[model samples]
Target: MHVFEGLEQRIQFMVLEVAKQVDETLRVLISPDEANIEKVTSRDDYIDNFKSVIENACFSRLHGQSHLDKAGIDFIRAVNIISNNLERISDFSVDIARQVQYLSDQRFLDQFEYRPFFRQILGALDIVVRALFHRDLSLALRICRAEFILDKLYKHNFDKIITRLQTGKEAQNLITTLFIFRYLERMGDSLLNIGEAVIFSVVGEKLKINQYQALRDSLDSLGVDLPLREVDFESIWGTRSGCRIGKVSGDNKGDSTGVIFKEGKHKKIFQEKINIHEWETILPGLTPKVFGFQESRGNASILLEFLTGCTFQEIVFNEDKEFFEDAFFLVQETAAMIWQKTLKAQPVPCSFIAQLSKRIEDVFVTHPEFNTPQVQFCNLMIPSTSELLEQLQQVELEVTAPFTVFIHGDYNSNNILYNQKEQRIHYIDVHRSTHGDYVQDVSVFLVSNFRLPIFDRIVRCKLNQVSLHYLHFARQFAQEYHDTTFEIRLALGLIRSFITSTRFELNEEFAGSMFIRGVYLMELVLAHQGRPWEAFRLPDRILRYRYY
Candidate 1:
């Protein structure tokens, strides 16, 4: 607390100094006084020096011997961002003052409405300390709104300058005036950053103004009376969906039933909302209940009931054998129920190759070494990455699912949750859910279990066992439904899942294993091409991690 207090005081001092710089710059702009111009320019050095002091203090508190809590670290981070932006504002003020010299006539600037720019900037700056220190969402929102006002003022003046330029008179003065307004506009940009940083400090998560508003609207829709400041937000990281997902709960931990808040592009979030509703219709309790949904200009947010359970990933790594078996059995039962209930008698071409093509570049971006070139081994031509893809594409053309089933598109282990007490299974991140070949989910589920970075022999053995068990179960389902190409189609799906998954993996050895397995599967599928598709068998060795 002492360290934070010290840093806050330093920031407050910096804010006051920067405010003085802006006020002095405004005076110089209104009535060009050589003394005032010098004051604004000279004081910039002091502001820079103060910024360095505050920055060093922040870093010291963060990396020093003293251990600080999460809130403390977030506060320090916000302070650092705020101080840096404040310094930028001061530099912009000095730049604006310098531009005043370019005005041939001081009244030349009088034609444009510049006074409101200063008024907005100064008003926003006035509340930076209070908004940040007091953790006031209202004040922070006010600060962010100032940027819009400044932008509008800048646009008006810009239009006027362009009109005056068309007259082909005083072009230089007009351009110079535009530079001053541009610098003013930049100050607004910095203020927006400062306001968001303050919000980050309060929420302890980096949320844009739009996202904050979306969250507010979503909570309001649910008739939740809690203030934004009272909501605790914990971000769920490691999500590749590009959505801002977090768990939101009220300050009263005992009484609060938390909800998952997700905000992203309007299309993605809206699609997810629709998918959730569809899933609810297919299986009543399979997906989280949507508490609220709101769409803005181009983004949307949804509030989902936070399902209480441990993910399948947790069950494998943490739970005992009995618990793991119960969870796995529930997963199998749930998969069977969903597939059987939604089975449609329609032939669907396997899209694994197409899916792989879309994401292959991303894979090479992460693991370029996996992109093999054609090579000759004992008069045998080994296909390159592209050639392998070509061969697989041709092979995939011959294999199609006999029937389609509604499936969880992204069937990763972590996406499946098992509520132990209730003995129930639930799925999350179901935006990709749709009526598709059930092999797609099977392959993803297998690779998801296999590619988990857990390297312990016992844990890996469990993962392998689970993967094999599910593979056999799926195979039996295929046989019962007279689906002949399930094995071949699943191989293609595995190849796609295995290779594309490497993009998210950084561990070279582990990623290399997955890449090799994918290539091996592709080769096997190609080797058995032109033969009865049902004869193409997926060797269990390909899925097992051999401890070498």
Candidate 2:
């Protein structure tokens, strides 16, 4: 082996050593025998020294004037991240050891009678350690992937401890158990960090591959199979808010995933029949292949077959223009299909004015002082704002448009998917689909594309004339997709409404909102296009959303 090869081997050895130490510490934590805990605590310096040596070696390589190959650089980066994660895991192990020692000193360790919780933490640690050393993303995924189970385990144990503390007369030991359980949960968290590091090392990206389809592509190329075992709402990755992302197995023929049990508010309120009916009827072909839906703990989660494709945003921005025409046409076609399906499924007309009115009311109630004469009429009274709002009011959306199909509530470029080999298009991120105005989908789609500014910022494309291109393409899309009328008016109306709703609260800060800036940009373009000056001014406080 060459010198870099030798260094790579050495780094791998160090990672495995740290993983071994982690395993040892976890074992001591589970049993908490005085001799074993003391031994693990005593080895803290050795872990620290190991880390110091690796850091010096990395620095030495950087200083030695030895040029590193792509693989070497990638390896060095991976090792560095892995080394840092291991160091943190070791620190956490030491913390667990100290907590265990304290519990033993007070004779509190014996009073707490739950060993299964420790076992769960130990399992999580073991999985994480193997994941890092072997770079087994499947194992790493199982570690991140098992967060929900361990989360429930912690919660169950926590409840037991809490119940004991509340009802029992002498419960100081329960408090210690709570702390110990907390350490165990923290151990799981450290394990999650290791999993994330492994994923970053493997995929070269972070949490971008959450949707099933994206994950499938990422793993398929690696020839790895990470099956979704079960949906655990309490799993570390199974939180209700934010992104609900998890992993599943790729191999389906061998071992099927276990049934996940969820008992939560979502199950009580959500109608499975309705969800199933909606999937079957409204989105016949749109729903992802449902593996199953279950209520775990107090959260409802569903597992579906992983998708294998790329996002429209990724395709448009990343791929070369030699493929641009085909990619753009695919996006246009996909959006058209989704738009048509949306129209047929849900033909109900929602009053945007009523919605805006309620939102305005909520804002006033939240900030009662905004009702003051100076504030209420202040920005609206401004010529620019009043003039802009007046132009917007001239355009009235009749909930009466003939097309009444299901509309993707947030139809943006991000939701469109592309398959290269099949030369096919798929629409995803369909959770927010609903029945609404055709223009609502159309206008929102057009406006969303304006957000990236990728053409303007990175590629040095002239955007002043980009509107012409946008208008031209949109018209072409309308004809190609469904032969709709050619007009930027609906898109402009959506932009105007978006500006009004967002800027009302931001009135004091007019130069903040991008919508406001976009309106300003519209004005500059309209000025160039020989449109009225009144068309360009933004509604009151609407400029606030555009900080710049």
Candidate 3:
């Protein structure tokens, strides 16, 4: 039987109950009779009971014997969310009705246009059943827009109440009236949530209304001619950057390869768009081609050509020895070509410590124990996190890259994709691509590989080998370029990457290992401060995973 066979009618009944409560609450505001107040408050229990019953049914279907398709699952989820929000609206109505009791005069609310608030809320509520059941995008948009309109109404009434309160003529009445309007505004908020739940059901992804609109605008700007309801959105999780990334494809089309839709702060998305263009100029086909970009208010969205290939992380974990080696060779070759083409003979001061400082707070937020105080260990004085960073910052000023090259700001393994058939490597997230020290990329790449949580001995061994191989290649490049402080600079870069990388890792043993490696590197650099930097050696043991 249908996934939501019994549940859909119950949710519709619940919505109707909430709408009636709101209607009674509005009448109580217009004329606060005891009976109207009692009617609004007493029915809240029925609405609450309806919510429980619907919620239990939704969960039961979810955990039932029959398997549900993605659409069925999404519908159940949307139904549950919609029911919860409808219950909230009912509660808010009771709250509004209670506030009417404090009004010194019921007509005090009449001075303000409160009917439009009810009209907006009730009109939106009238469509909840139809919009959610039909999966109608236009109806969902209408429901979402009611929140914006109600917000405007609330603001207008709020200003009027503030002005009247300044007169001290009816301060209590004005405040009580404001409370009623606030509850109405909150009811509008519930409508927005209900509308977004419907959108989620239609799209099979949880997207805020603004994000959905941005995606639609981005697609329209590209002349994609696809409706929002007809598109499939598959969320790309595992990112800490607070950006919404998804793979979008036309649901009706079988041949669509899909495109990457990214939405975030305008500054970041815009910078990425600019950076992609720069990469195209420096090396065509190195980055994904931007299909369209749209910025509205403070947020932006971009549609990018989705690169079809396995990420470098996938190859390292799943591919055979020959395939992994071939991919690694391609990575090395790509780096060499990009660095050679974009190299600028200008000394850029190392900002490893500075970058570390920016993210150290985040590290401490995740692993507070990493922020230790100075400790005594035999004859040596171990530095605290702060003390180590301060010393590194002082020494970092003296070191600089002899030449600058365009580097991927985030050189993680997953960000680099390799297409075996075409034998090509493409960069996916190019927001941080710019002219900078090459060691930045090198250090980040090594740490990214080391930070993978794979514990299998064979995979870990491969990771260790690849990290050392890449390090050797970077050292060779530095030597050829005559970067005098290459070793010291790389040590600083590694220290920065290793320390910040721990913030994303939650495994205590693994995170502590990375943190200790960073501290050890710091001590090594600090000890060699007065000596010649070239003689300093990077211990490979710190990079390798050792079994106890």
Candidate 4:
């Protein structure tokens, strides 16, 4: 066989070998078959070697075929990616087999009905091989679609595991099985990436096909002047939030209009609409001019004005000391400006504490991992969810505001846009915007600044200083409004937002550090329970609690 043909055949052989692993894993999953365990486990070495061989073959071909074009190189690299993903599939299969081999029982619980998934994945492998060989975009599309199906199955099985946890079933067995399911689910993701690589190779350009389709449909529905295909769609990263955000802009007769596109669940998108309209009415020009909204396929996207300016965070963190000092004052003044607008507006009829109580309930249900001390967060201790709820209830939230005020539920620096030239602030990603305690927005703003991923001691110190100034700004608003609950309620809001946030973040050091702050605030709320609300103080530094 020719060198190129040999490489292609090797890629096929690698996937087929991975198919065997998944096939054997199914037998082990259904029944503790020792031979299936042995077969899958022993082949891990071979699979690893196969990956190395395929990778080296691709590179060697590139080196030998000096006349190869970029397309030829891309084909080689795509095959390499596929081989790597297939090897991972084998590794996961071996992990599953090892779990089964160590099982003391002859039968494992099939609560997830995982046998069909094995068949599905094996089928996916077959299709992937064909797609790679022929560069068949249709087969690649099918593989991508299979990932969605696999995700649904994974969620169904994950919820089953959580339900088992609620029932107080066998912990060790359930945890191990949970890890196995995680492996299977990750295999699905790796396969998805492989399929995407196929599409990338075929298209000769990069775009998340699903989102590109959604964005195109969105611009079409809006009847925007930009041509559907020509509209540049670039994925924007949300490092701190779970929103699939993008920026789409185009030229119409040399007049370009930029719009931000955000996609998320139906409810979140719906809330964003309400919040945007609320700001439009009460605090006009304080948010981007929302162009339109669309919902379909259990997801929603919105297009709005993409304001041009640095984030308040960028201004605050800029290296110029004078700029930082000036920006610090300006940020606080802006906070005061926005807080005052809501101080007189009609509230959403939901009390902040009542809303907080519901969120605390969600925290308990979603983040039950924090229930056990063995979870090992920071050294600072936290109360059980139940106990924390009880302590939270003891605080008095009835403040003497003339009435409720519209509050930005997520007032983080990243969410708020600043135009230094225009001296205006615009809010985006306002899904959580609701009418609640001014203190709720205030507390969120404070913690949002606090939780930023900055580690420089001096920068952190300055950021904390700015946060304290912002809080003092909020307190001034509170004192003027005759609202007495700012201090304690801020603590409660921090606890609710921070502890619940643990589920979204996976970084141990960052998450653990945040957990410590949450626990510290929780303990303070419990200690000063029934005391004067103003007597408590928000900490100047998050790391200070680390010494405890």
Single out the weakest 10-residue window by summed lDDT for candidate 4. Answer: 225-234
TM-score of candidate 4 relative to the true fold: 0.59
Stretch of 10 with least lDDT, candidate 2? 233-242
Candidate 4 structure quality by residue, lDDT tens digits, 227-337? 111111111322111133444455565656666666555677777788888888876887787788999877666777777766666666678876556555666666676
lDDT of 4 at 154: 71
Q: Which stretches of candidate 4 lie over 4 Å from their true place?
A: 1-91, 102-253, 264-266, 295-297, 344-371, 374-386, 393-403, 501-507, 530-548
Task: Compare candidates 1 and 2 on lDDT and give the better one.
Answer: 1
Hey, what RMSD does candidate 3 come out at?
15.2
- Looking at model 3, the pairs that clash are none
Q: Rate the local accuracy (lDDT) of all candidates.
A: 0.82, 0.49, 0.80, 0.65
Worst 10 residues of 1 by lDDT: 225-234
Using lDDT, give the best candidate's number: 1
Cα error of candidate 1 at position 136, Å: 20
Give the TM-score of each candidate.
0.60, 0.40, 0.60, 0.59
